[model samples]
Target: MVSYGLEEKTALMTSLTDKLASTENSLIESTGRLDRIKEAFHRSEARYHSLEEMERNLEGYQEGVKSILLSKGGDTSPLAGIHGIVADFLDIITPAPNIPNRDNIEGELQAEKVIEAVLGERLQNIVVEGQEDTKKAIEFLKSNCAGRTTFIPKRPRPEKYRIEGKALQQLSNISGVIGPAMTFIEFREGYEALAEYFFSDVVIVDKLETALNLLKETNSSYTFVTIDGEVVESSGRITGGISNGKSPGLIQKRRELRALKNELLRLEREVSGTEGEVERAKNEKVLLQVQIENINKQIHEETIRIVNIDKDIEALIDDEKRIQLRIETLCLEERGIDSEISNLSSELNIYNEEIQRLLAEQAEGEQEIQGLIESQKLGRERWEEAQRGITTRKLELATRKEKRESLSVRLKELGERIESATTLTTDKEESLSKIDQKIDGYLREKSGIESTITDLWQKKDAISKEIVAKENERAGREERQRLSEEELKEKRRVMEDIKKEINQFEIQKAEIRLETGHLKETIYTTYQINLEEEIKNLNLKDLNIDELTSSLTALKERLNRMGPVNLASIEEYQELNQRYEFLTSQESDLTQACETLHKTISKINMTTREMFLNTFNIINEKFQYLFQLFFQGGESKLVLTDENNVLDSGIEIFAQPPGKKVSQLALLSGGEKALTAISLIFATFLARPTPFCVLDEIDAPLDEVNTERFINSVKDMTGFSQFIIITHNKRTMEA
Candidate 1:
């Protein structure tokens, strides 16, 4: 029974030992698998976070689209009609349950790059409900002075381009050609029109060569985009290149984000499964250990029993041998006493009875020894089983030691990886710090350059004004010189006239003297009185030559036909000469005053022109700078309607926002006009900062992002100017 029990226990122990070995191996494998799964899970999680962050930040979106998305606050009313950008609606072609070949088709087509290449910049285009929404979005953009963007209406416009049936048939026949580009993409329900609008004339091919072949085989009215993002235009232009993976396109990024999310989920599932497996393996290991301990305990108890039985059988054999030796000695004594047999017969019979009892006891001792031998054999078998169990345990221990070593190695590797990661992180941080330092240095340099430019602009304006003033002064001097020359010529003419009059007067005086001489001679001949002596003695207050001549003519009336003369004519001539002299003095004074007044007016006009040109130039430079700031990039200037007449010339503002044509202020969109006007105002402020400024809803047209910029600008001016801004915008109010 003990042997049978030992045999059963040995079998069980052997089986348990095998189970324990397998469990240990399984536990080791499960632990390794769990670690791998956990590592993969962490990696996937990190990647998912990175992609999520990228999406959240709108990293690849255009400036205008980013602005729009960022400015759309919790309230959806303003952006209610907006259906997001075109890229948002596009997705990778998914395998449909009904289509067995869908995955194959999807794999063959590079949907992301193909769509990205086909859509081009239109991926950033905002989709709107209609023209009204487009108008609203435009207004929003203009108000914010955000960058410009294109808009696609939800209501599809008439299709102006369609692939010809014959061309389609020919394309289908062409090898390596996918169908229309639209067929490889999936979009939202209402965005079918947009898809069609953007993809109607585009075809997809597997390669550039295939595209070229297809183009040659068919009418050259289709634009083909290859799977590698190469493009073949209908106008016989081909563009093909490799892309550096630094900045993956927006569509590619979106695709990667989705893939990352799915991968992360899968990793999470795998991790959970692995963790469960590891737990089960550990539990099994614990149960096997318990079973092994119990088997060893049973083996130990059976060995102790076998050892006790062997000790008992040895003691019994010793007693049996001693009794046999005693019986032999008694028989020898009885043989020597054979002659006295009669006398010792009774004693001998008693001794024989004792011997018989001793024999029976010896037989019983042998039977017990045989049973103990059988028990020893069973115990020996159990000992061998226990030895096998020990061997298995040693193997298990070795396996466990190996597992521990493997875990240690894995841990060491993980530690090394962590150290390397830490080192890499440190290096990245150092690099980032260096980059930041470089950026700061560049910013400082940029600021210095800006300041220098401003100073240069100021110097240029000052020099221009000085030059204008000098020109005006030179012009005035030339004008004054011309007037002086004309005045001197008139004076010379007057002097010549005076000389002619003087000569004529001399001739007339000579003739009068001759006449007087003749008269004197006649008088001397007739009345013998010297005329000179008579004239000197006479009181000639009223005496006139004509009157005297008349008297003489009367005396000799017939000698000459002299005209009649009045004596008061001499006084009248004297009065008229005095009046002419007074009038000439008045004319000279009036001319001088008029000349002074003309000079003053000219000075005033010149000063006004100088000031206007100076201010205009300064404002123009500022406007150009501010326009570039507000619109991100563009050109703008203040033009004079009439350069010849700066003082009275009208200023025409010409502005060109980034990605737009140069247009007059009136021709720009409302938001563009607002931004342009705001830029002008800011430029004016910068040119001539005021002590205090009042802005009433100036930011009303601006979105949140633009309002933030406006606020920042306002803050920059707070050092020199005070601003009173009236606004309803939350961002503005918060600022």
Candidate 2:
């Protein structure tokens, strides 16, 4: 009962174990499902994050593009003027410049400087009247303007300067050259005219000493400048100092943007290389797979051979067992036959002994008959019966002998059959043993091959994993490439947007500047006022019309209430205005006459000054060459004494005589003065070409050397003007 109870308990435990096992299986399945769900959740979260990030990035990109065009709350960009499609392409192709102060700057040197920077000096030069170098710059800019400065400004005529051949690159003493004044302002294309007009003559030098030297060397021909922003006038005077130049940040930003484009090109090249490597890896993996297929084919053939060998070994074993069973059965039969023959032989031997005992009993019965005549008959009868039994025993012995002989023959046959069966079994067993050995060898070889195949499979699996990893890496790289492409596209889109905005800003800036200039010109022309200064601090506010009307009505009512107060004052004012008009008319008539006289004088003065200027220019040109001839080697120039007032300006001669410090004309010797006077008279005559000239002892105090110079000077002017010389010196007369 205890054992039975123990068995029952064991059965119950087994049933519980089975149920627990089933529950474990269910739990494992549920866990796998949960793991898959978790993985899916993670993937969804990552995707959502990526999407959100992309959205933010896109918004930022758009804002950045917009900001590139916005400055001072206005869009003075080239993109504004350009058509939409072309502007987008323009962004991809060119480096756009940033204009500063689009809203507040116009008709100033700063504005022109910005224009020059955007459109380049060559284009600005073309847009403004300038020297030969300027024209050359214009041509150069035109030749190279395909991808740069898409917008151009209306032409402006600024003051002309003779910046010629040797002057083009002759910023020798320049400390650092700032661009044309157009480079400084952010106003649009039209504003370039103002900058060009203002900053045309600015040239920066290294130091004050350099500026002074430049001023001295060229007679301050250009507006010389110091690096610290000190300006030198053409008359060797300095003005403006201490950093008057604007920042070059806009130009710097343009260069940086160009650099970024170059970086984009470089990264694109790298991406191309990565793509090629990925393609190569794919090709290599394909080759590896081909090799794996070939190996698999060989392994499959070997596996089939091993299976066939196993089947052959099993069949041989079955045949050997059948042969062994046959041999054992034959051996048992042979032993049974031998046992039957032996039993027959033993029975035959017993028959022979019985027969002999019967013969002895017959002899004993004959002896007893002889010994007792009276009982002879009973003895003979017993003896005869014994002889009869002996005869039967003899017959039985003969039959038994015959049966033994036959049995021996049968045993011999059985023995021979057993020997044959044993031999056959032995052969079969040997064959079976050989087959087992062969099977064992094949099995061992198969095991080794199988082990090698298992190793190959393991290696293949590892290689597959590596390939999977490589594929994943390639996929990752491809994804990154795709992302990079998307980013590049985004950048391109932003750049296009920026370009369009910049173009628009440029157009707007031009319009705004034009309008501002027109407004100023109109205001000044109509009101004779500096409108810009007046409006600089002015702001307009909206008025409530209803409130203003109510106030006006109240004032009218107050005036009505104070009626009859100004009637007499009005009458008196009207009477006084009539008298005043009569006096004013008389004054006006006198003022008109004075104005007419002043105008006549001014017109006459203007004509005289104009004629003087024309003649002076011709004379000045001749004088320079003439002075060089007279002095041998030095420069001389004619300057205005009162330059600020051209009509009343007096001529001041500046001559650097050869081997002499020509500080003042009064310091010259008498002979030198005479020479200088002759040169000037000759130059003047050459300019206007007077028909007649008379000299009264002009060379009265001349030595031989002076006389020779005098004769030459007279001869030079002999072409157009007749000269009469009353010289005591024979040398002067002869020459």
**Considering every candidate listed, which one attains the maximal lDDT?**
1
Model 1 C-alpha lDDT per residue in residues 612-664, reported as the tens digit of each score: 88888999998998889788789999899999999878988899888977577
Error of 2 at 166 (Å): 7.7
What lDDT, from 0 to 1, does candidate 1 have?
0.70
TM-scores vs. true structure, each candidate = 0.43, 0.34
Task: Please identify model 1 stretches exceeding 4 Å from their true place.
Answer: 74-76, 95-108, 164-166, 213-219, 321-735
Local distance difference test, each candidate: 0.70, 0.55
Candidate 2 per-residue lDDT, tens place, 150-191, comes to 222334466746343456346432333332232233334335
Candidate 2 Cα errors over 4 Å, as ranges? 1-277, 293-409, 457-735
